[model samples]
Target: MLDIAAELHEWVRQGRDFAVATVVAVDGSAPRGPGATLAVDTGGEAVGSVSGGCVEAAVYELCRQALRDGRTVLAPFGPTADDPFATGLTCGGSIDVLVTPVPRTSPARSLTARALAAAANGRPTALARPLPSADTPEDPRPLLVHPDGAHEGTLGGPPELDRWAAHEAAALLAAGRTGTVPGCPSTGRPALFVESSAAPPRLIVFGAVDVASALVGLGAFLGYRVTVCDARPVFATPARFPAAHEVVVDWPHRYLERTEVDARTVLCVLTHDPKFDVPLLQLALRLPVAYIGAMGSRTTHEDRIRRLRETGVTEHQLKRLRSPIGLDLGARTPQETALSIAAEIVAVLRGGAGPPLTGGRTPIHHDAPGRVRRPELRPPGTARTSPRNR
Candidate 1:
């Protein structure tokens, strides 16, 4: 639904009318989960996908018709009694979609638009839908929450449904995950799809010098919204850290006083100076940031840990810090070191053991664009050659 919400906002912003098709139910081997949405604007532009290309064209035609008629309708496409392949979904399952034409200003449309605006401003939001009682067994209602507590709409149903969703939303906010809740009808279970968004995690590099510059560059490329903080003004110039979103030339601990760190944030102590690193480590070890990595040798790490313990950082708290800052990739150069650090961050965020893809089965992204995107290994500064040519 976050994908649908974002794309629908884009569609309307471009001066187009569109209709959304949502899968309300599925019986058999459906490719997508229920609550899956596909929106097609009047201009034939589409975002979000319903089926695996088998029913997109048909869904587009329906969207065009709905836009013309200004009506909201439910479409059941599958092996119905009259036409099996008429709807183009022949995957031996049924998909019931709520096709709602979005007016320039309608209730659902307004809610989604506000939700998108909140997400754009790095705010958290939730979108809730009331499930049909008779049609499905799963608790069909779900609220989509963002990282900052902003949400789109609500289930407008009984207070019980809303309360259950709010509880789930809090959990989703904490974990930054999206999924469905089942058994909400007093069974204490509900089927829902929850998607969470947080501010792109922070990567604070404590040095503003050469290695810091390389790390900042790599961090930005990896989507960390990098910040470079150093007490030294000469080296912490924006020119030195071009890829950094912020360059702070202030005492590291003092600067952290004004910043908020969450479990999603990463604090990297890159300066080898005890004056900066020790104080910054004090603050970082006390915070809940997911990863506190310091760039130092094994000896430096052990020494720092001992000093931290002396300063009342318990072993439990000190466990959060990752000394040496990256996997043992045997990297020797600045660029290679940056790669190792970025890879470690990725591994942490993904909650994986950094294994090869051959062992993984989860989709690279949930409801990622049907359009082919380049793999993560594409070289920097290289154009992504389209897959169509191959």
Candidate 2:
């Protein structure tokens, strides 16, 4: 699955056979949504997760068995009121997991490798496969779709059906979504699990301070393509923020004015200086970005708001700014502060707060309707124990 693309990319490169189980569909209150994966290698090593610790052992063995038998297995987990034997997920929701094997000699290996490599390297790609039904019950094969409507491989069906699926998949790839798409009605077929992915979201940090360096690594870890911009060339060097994908030595506002951003971009104004942050926030708040967080103290935030009011920024745009950014984690050091900021960014995007989960009866998983975000790409370790790459 694209969720564990970095690890699976390595597996394909090394020619190590493995079976990966993906949560293709969810009904009710499941822990993970579609595209979540759990993979097991030939040596019983595993990476990633598909549930909240429930049904994992069963899924793990399912992956292992898939590797041995070279068969595609569609297993269902979770408790249903009508079923007597429900082994996992007591939380009233169920998940349908599809396990596919990519052995060294399997026919699916080449296409699987191309998808994994594209996702791991932050390229746009879509992997579309059909779900089984009583009417059409052939073993689903992958069809790799690209943004330009180009595609490779086949769905083991009619050519027109494959073309229709590719067209739908290219549309989803535009939004970086991963989920089931309605099949071509002309063919009277329904449902193809289309997991489409695009380039990772952008995280632009406006300041080359020490916290900027620390936050760059955290942003990259969170799977954002990070860019550190500062006017000072000496500070905004590649050596300072080595983890960042780009380091630009230009005024923050000037650079942002020319840069391309979208709904998934995150703007972090770490330079609390009125000269830099004020002009930057003036431009950032008006842009269509997911988050606009500025680092400052409460008193500094108040002063900054006053300055923005004088600059003719509308109240609606001002309301979008999160000055004194980050959660109240009592963060002291640079790393802790970066973590707090990252947590707040995630919370804002996921519609969550910084409250402890133990006291709350709310569902643990939050499924943003009509929007599916691909999980972060975590590279696997060579260690045989503690195998999960997350």
Best by TM-score: 2
Candidate 2 has what TM-score? 0.81
lDDT string for model 2 (1-390, tens) is: 998999999988887999989988776688888889999999998999999687788889888888888877667665634444545676777777878888888777899899999999988999987765544444567889999989999877678777888998898887677887655446665577788779888999999998898999999999899999999998999998999999999999999999999888999999999999888888888898899999999999999999998998999999899879999999999999999999999988877777888989776666653564322111254221111210
- Model 1's TM-score against the true structure: 0.70
What would the TM-scores of all predictions be?
A: 0.70, 0.81
How would you encode candidate 1's per-residue C-alpha lDDT over 1-390 as one tens digit per residue? 454666666766876677777765554546765557788776777788877776677777777788888765555566433453355454555555556677675556666666666665666555544433343433232345444444434565555665667676656556554444443445533344444444577888888766677889888887788899988898889988879999998998888878877777888788866777787888888887778888889888888877888888888888788787887788898888877877787777656555556778643323322211112222367432211111
Task: Name model 2 segments beyond 4 Å from true.
Answer: 6-18, 27-31, 40-48, 64-71, 79-86, 90-93, 103-108, 156-160, 182-187, 309-312, 372-390
Q: Which residue pairs come into collision in candidate 2? A: none
- Top candidate on lDDT is 2
Global lDDT of each candidate:
0.65, 0.83
Q: In angstroms, how far off is 196's CA in candidate 1?
A: 3.6
Error of 2 at 107 (Å): 5.0
